[model samples]
Target: MKIKKLIQALPAFVMLTSTGVLANNGYVNFPYPTVISATPSANTQTLSSTEYWEVVRGDELKTGVAISFTGNKSVVLLSPQYSHDMNGQKRAPAVAENAIELHTLQGKASLSATYNRDEMSGYGFAPGSAAVQANKLAGQNATLRLNQKISDDDLYLLHVKESDSPYQLNVESNVMVQEEAALVLHADVTGAKNIKPKLAIQVSAPDGQSIPYHFTNDKLAFDAPLEHVGAREGMYNVVVHSHSMVNGLEVKRSVRLPFVHQRESASVITYSLSEQTAKHVTANVSLNVSQEGRYGVVATLMGYRDGKQIALATSEAAQDFSTSETLPIRFTLPKGATGPYQVNILELKDQTRLQRFVQNELVTQ
Candidate 1:
């Protein structure tokens, strides 16, 4: 009877021990059915500073196997146990506790600008991994150099367990680029999720001239012309897009530049003209110069309509006029010629051709 009692108690002790290990831990499901058969060689696998892991979801079993860090420090059971007596006394064992110590895990550091899920780098820390007793199941890690200074104490890395089964992972980093304020025409050149290797960066101003810029690594810089910088400043959107080869995933970042004010004025010296063909109309046409400040000396002339082209002998401007000075165009008929006609004038203002004509005030037969 003593021997039989001892034998009966053995199963109970094993059950209790197994049940205790199952409590207060996390779980990771692998992709294919993977048995956690071997313990990682402790202190032997010093993973790369940027090493990470990848696995399918729901693949970890609950019983008959377990996995842990090299020193048995952190262990997780993938399977569960079951027992049933002939009298229908069935007792299913509790799920094993996850061995990964949540407190030991660090948050992910900053990520490279090119970081993406399809391209998983080594895992180091995960964002919010600073919590205690959480599993380090996020399949990623990064190794720190022997000599590196970390400034921000609250910073953390980003991580996801195999249970989440993220297609890609991004590890945040500490480095950031500084933005310099300047008046420029900025453009974003990045591919889309459905596109690759073909990105366009272009910016156009109101004057129809392109603003120059430069891009290297992941930083964008403006190299606009010095003269046009004042005119190129304004509201513009810049973007960089990314597309995934697998599953056709797409991502993009768009930046809206604050309104930059630039000083500019019209350069194309232009004017309007009108013509009538039935009566002798004496119309006073005026030409308004657009530019300010004197641009050297220039001659002004008024052109009178005679069929298709204006006869140069019709009229001309006074030599004493200054730049941007508007002059009235006067024309008188040589008595009886017809009942209706048209009038126009051309002024030579600082080597530019300025012309104006009557928009109305035409008497017809």
Candidate 2:
């Protein structure tokens, strides 16, 4: 039962990692893995870390993690990012005590960084001679074990680098899962184009059934598309694999990412704008919630004056809704907000089971 629960939460972790690691860079998706036309790639698995803390969210509690690496030379960069709080603040000094122990068949402790309540400079913990000594990895599988000194409640990022590789065989999407009609994807092997990257993609439904794909044969890039299939109200994952060779060596890279499939049972029946008082404009979203749970509505109330784009106010609130009818959200208009306004709904979330966020698109009168 414990293992099952952990597996279920993996999708959220992948989504979070993608948002941070995958740089959109206007159009390009890589420095090492240059993607021509794509959406995102978290990181190449040629060198990977076992951030057991990821399975448990922010806390680094209970049992260390063992990481596995590929490639002839590799080094592990361990550091904790700035910690945040509910009130939107960054914790200072970035104190931590993470221990790294490297092991190969040859010897142990090739490189180690022990942070003991160490005050970090917000960039990273000072790694000493680890990258220089990565030659210890000479064509052998290396394992780096990290034991958290205190993982009760802290967020961290683990950086593992294959220092000598020219290109990383990777896959990516041109969109964030679904874009109106289909999910577009690409196999990026630009750094090592000698491989003539052959790309394959597979999508799985929330129920673990394989969703099919169609070859795009796009003229601009090496890409494909997968239809959005199934509606089981859980998580859907896309598995992409690329096979190629560089410098007479076979190189293969695979990346898997998860996106949520939400049910459209909750919606805005109607919304109206009314000036109820001397201080606020009440923009009421008549919502129809199919499931009983906590719900939130966020919207922007806009009004124009002097024949130009004018004053704006934001409305935000949450309520425990139990199959109710209309819910009213009020926004305090800033000074100089005038007549003939529009209530643009920003987001409506079911903030409960599955937390279905629905964007209500209705033009106000």
Alpha-carbon runs more than 4 Å astray in model 2: 1-72, 75-164, 174-183, 194-196, 199-236, 305-307, 356-362
The digit string of per-residue lDDT tens for model 2 on 92-171 reads: 22323334566666767455343212222232444321212344443354455444444455544544445355556454
lDDT of 1 by residue, 25-50 (tens): 12111111121212222211111111
How far is 36's C-alpha from truth in model 1 (Å)? 77
- Backbone clashes for every candidate come to 60, 2
What is the alpha-carbon lDDT for the whole of candidate 2?
0.49
lDDT of 2 at 356: 38
User: How big is the positional error of residue 266 in model 1, measured in Å on the Cα after superposition?
Assistant: 3.5
Error of 2 at 147 (Å): 25
